[model samples]
Target: MDRTLTTATTAKIADAATAGSAHAVGLAEWLTRRAARAPHKPALTCNGITWNYGELIERIERMSAVLAAGGVTPGARVGYLGLNDPMFVVVLFATARIGAICVPLNFRLSGQELAFIIGDAGVHTLVVGEEHIAVIDAVRTDLACHCFIHRGGAVPGWESADALMAGARAERSLPVAVPVRADDVAVIMYTSGTTGHPKGAMLTHGNFWANNLNEMFLWDMVSTDVTLNFAPMFHVGGLLCGSMATLLAGGHLMLQRAFDAEAVLHAVAAHRITVSFAVPAMLLFISQHAAFEAADLSSLRLIAVGGAPMPEPLLRLYGARNIPVHQGYGMTETASMITFLHPDRSSDKLGSSGTPPLMTEIKLIDASGEPVTAPGATGEICVRGANVMPGYWNRPEATQASFTPDGWFRSGDIGYRDAEGFLYVCDRIKDMVISGGENIYPAEVESVLYDHPDIAEVAVIGAPDARWGERVVAVVAPCPGKSITLEGLHAFAEGKLARYKLPKELRIVDALPRNSTGKVLKATLRVHNVATATGSP
Candidate 1:
């Protein structure tokens, strides 16, 4: 009896030890708990398919096992080049499960650019979507990775994702139990290179969880909220704010492969999407679509806009339609949103980026590194928060330089806070155009031009000028059936802009060059050797 009692006690102690060690707070572990708690809850809905929390967890487990079997161990870099498919989410969580870092390649990048990132990140495996297979094929010779997984269909020398998942089912296998710590680097998001080669921002699992918490707090997200992800999954705004936020709140996510204004409009109504995030340009396009007048938008309660300056007219339109436009501010370094304008203050605090979310501290500093305390004093915005990335991947010097001695990350954006503690962004310090002796912020000029009825899309960039250091130029895409002339722009901006802020040159095109997140690629515009004068300024 004594021996049996001792054995029972030992078994109980072992079980207690196991229970204590079982809980993990990594980005992916939250999903596992959600699955256990709400197995029947709709988790992801995309392309006519809906997966419940339980089924989604199973798929993620299978994908994680598949990745492990393919020699992807802890700390391995896995590159993904794909559209905004639900599979991307699976791959991301799978990477997190095995403690591997996911490097989501921007499909819009050139073959050389893609090769550079792949090599820099030391990626051993690449997963390419069907549409981008040719893009990978072009750069395969330069890529160091030997393993390729294709998502849509069979490709020579590429393992089919469908087949691999099927094999996992046939084998009745489970994911290898790899310990993933909260601080483990989950993703290395490459910055969109407006100046030079992109640097990878190492976002740890803790950073992701913090961002999700911020999203939940700011958006007041609930599990019943049906969210739509129209933005590209490769971008932080789409992945973090759109899908991940919903997943964190135990809400349903509707995924789109790509952004089509009509498709987004239809999906919102069809799926009863309650919340979404988009760039200013996307919001404009969707609002202007013909279906906007007919589509049942009663379900959409909140829409967050970012990535560019939000035009006042767009805000007014949403207000008129009884939908709230919440403008947010953040970058790749912060995972997603650091500051967001509340829906109630969208009109009253027009153009303000809003206050910093909980646990995020924001301060502005001048050139001499002195803090700007006075309200309305423009300074480089700096932030420190749990959501902020640990540092640039493999770039220690850059990482060190990004933060101040006090541990705040320099945002490089020139902005100021109002008396009410609302944040208003002026412009990017690097993007400031200096013509002769005057400092001209392109956003100010762009905002003025955007107000014009004839203009559909506008980007202000500084063109090289031997005479004036740099000349203010406007690259515009006119509204349908409307033509924009330099004279018309000058007349429209005569009173609103100063002489130096006015566009010295105008180039009308079919569309403006934009990044995946709808940010106008001003660097690309500067290289266009086209110049036309409607008349001498």
Candidate 2:
């Protein structure tokens, strides 16, 4: 049977599912519908436990009851801090069930950072895993959250989620799912905020629904497909990119607490996983694993990759194994993916980020705000779509500055379209380095250095220079048993890159600093470089 769903077929399925419903767009409704249709089907698996659709929905309903009983009403903010687990998914649906907004906190953030977000969102109730309870405790006095619920074993002052859920089930009084409009806010996802404090992006139920439709149009997702999701669920790439889409399609989702390259290989083979999502760094680690060549990965039909471009070497490695890696472009503000390069065209397009999804529109605009119509003419990428967030939560000025007067959401990334309309992302507007009188994109420079045998990982950043205003600096994590020097790097790239684009300095490190989602922290690197240069502690 053909698994690919056409746009009209997917729309019909959605319409039929919600024909008479007033609150059809609420995300929790999707689980309810799926459970009614396929109660016995495996829906989620984590840490050797599997929950079918029926059991999953029951858990969500009970959790919803517990939250409502604890004073979480419509429009309230509920924060969740934990590793990737079925509970995270449950809390998201449970919060949405009662017309509350889910705030997924990054597990890797410091206590201070987490406190800022919890306070900013004015979270009424916060759910956390036992491992993270201490972090929350450190900042408990600073937060306004009234209720603390623990996911695992009991804590001193926190309510036990397991016990509350048991009590809720015994009561047999499931609260009726609240009605929500399509544009009603369902989640307040905070950005990474490399420059300043993170801003919460208010994503509506319709934004997620539109993203799911876009994924269904691009991927051959089916009920039988088993998906492995090990990326951090706090990020858009991990949650909406493939995990939620799989659940919506009635597919099995195998969750991992965190990414372990060897374990990922074993799970794919043991479970015959068919679909997954990861960043390029995860793919590189998987490819470099000792068992990669021998692992049985034939069951994987699609591996949706975002966060960064997949290096050519990794793409070829996966290609030889017959596993397709689809590259996509998106951010927290865009729900998940705006553009997806089909695997069939991966080779031809090479570095392109594919075309906009079915319900999204993308354009490029010059610095003067005029359309950049000619192919290969680089400009700031812009997007206009239902999937786009309405605005940053409670920050009207920031939201206004992020969009054009006509309503297109400015992406802040520099890119250009080929004649075929495929987007080639150059670099972020802020990351672009201007030296003397010329413009340079660090991504372009990093792409070249990535091919060097001695470089295991590299990030190109600009450092202040006396003569040129700014100079290119290559920060490299050398391959094991290898070392690199500025002279050697220049020699290797002499012919490949322009003289001005070549790195003016080299800094060797054991590993590059990265966020949980595997994006190199260039801002951190720049700050560290400045401190070292100035001999600051």
Q: Can you give the TM-score per candidate against the true fold?
A: 0.79, 0.80
Which residue ranges in model 2 land beyond 4 Å of their true spot? Answer: 1-19, 432-537
Compose the digit string of candidate 1's lDDT tens values, residues 1-537: 011112332333234334544335576677766655566688898898888876676677778888888999889999999888878988998888788889998776667668888998999889889898987798788888968998955778889987887677512465554667667899999873333456899998888888888888888899999999988888888888767878877899999888899999889888899999887667777888988988888898899877665777777887788888788888889887768888788777888999998858799999988999899999999999888888998888889988998899998889999998899987676676655423466766777789999899988887666445467888888899998888889898875554556888888778888889998787778777544444342
lDDT of 2 by residue, 255-337 (tens): 99998999999999999999999877678778888999999998999999887667777789899999989999887899988
lDDT of 1 at 105: 81
- Any idea what lDDT model 1 has? 0.79
| lDDT score, candidate 2, position 456 | 98
Best by lDDT: 2
